[model samples]
Target: MSTPTSPGEGAPTDALGRALRLVSFAMLGGVVAIAAVAVFTVGDEAGSGVDAFGAILVSVVFVAAALFVPRRLVRPWPATAAPNEVKAAGQLRSAAFLSLVFAELPTLIGLVNSFARGVWLPVAIGALFSVAGLLLTAPTADRLREWLARMESAGARTGL
Candidate 1:
């Protein structure tokens, strides 16, 4: 009888890609959950435009962070030797983790603003930004291949 292959028995890149996608989807779902919670609990305590200013500004900054921080995190891999799949996977995972965390920040901020000030606009704005960030940074198969190719090219360049 043939023994069944384990979940992680695939190539490192494949396994890592699957894990990243799962985490990304979970984070996106959390944004939806935040919206549901706010709808059910937050009251129509209409906030002044001035009161929403801070939440809007903070959410914008967090969304920008979600867009840029992950690229910086993965940019410093030591390509002095050769591109190692294991090391590349580690770096990708780190970048993806930060990407998801940063993306989720706006939703959390929105939830806080809703509970504290009862403004619903920030929740909607934040959820929109959060979803965009999550979708943009999601580790799909094409993205994974591109990243690996870039790492390989960098390694080749530095090896000379």
Candidate 2:
């Protein structure tokens, strides 16, 4: 289905979505970057729970600010493409939100491991899945329109 939003019209939402996407992914990437910089920078190991918590916190803070900040600070930019393109922006935004939310669980688990004791192997595996989930659903905002159509069709068949 076609997205109804104009490209730049959803900038506020779009920006938040983009922020969520990048920041969450960065949590994972940052770990790699940090490890490369120094295998042992902290008292705890590089791949410990504290690192994961820090990464997730950074992503959440960035996204929350983008979502709640005044439009003045988060001004809407002009449409990058035709009006048709704008429609998909909302889907992208939604996808970003969902992807980030999905990512948090594994990160949170990893975060907890920092304070407590848990098996890193499972949490690490879960984190990879979370990252994949986020990436796979990045286009979710656009899919909302499609889902709506399916719902409507189902309702009609059921005589609702």
Instruction: Provide the TM-score for each candidate, comma-separated.
Output: 0.78, 0.37
**Candidate 2 on 1-160: residue-level lDDT in tens?**
2223666655333444456556656765754343333323223434555655655555455344333332222122233433333443444444445445554455454434533543343234344544554454443344333332332332221111
* lDDT of prediction 2: 0.42
Find the candidate with the highest lDDT and give its number: 1
lDDT per model vs. reference:
0.71, 0.42
Residue 43 lDDT, candidate 2, scale 0-100 = 31
Error of 2 at 54 (Å): 22
lDDT of 1 by residue, 1-160 (tens): 0111355554446767888999899899989888777857687765677646766787778878877887666553445665455566777778778878988888788888777777776776678788888898788766665555555554442110
Off by over 4 Å in 2: 1-96, 140-160
What is the Cα-based lDDT of residue 116 in candidate 1?
A: 77
Model 2 pairs whose backbones collide: 5-86, 5-87, 6-86, 7-86, 49-114, 91-141, 91-142
Number of backbone collisions per candidate:
0, 7
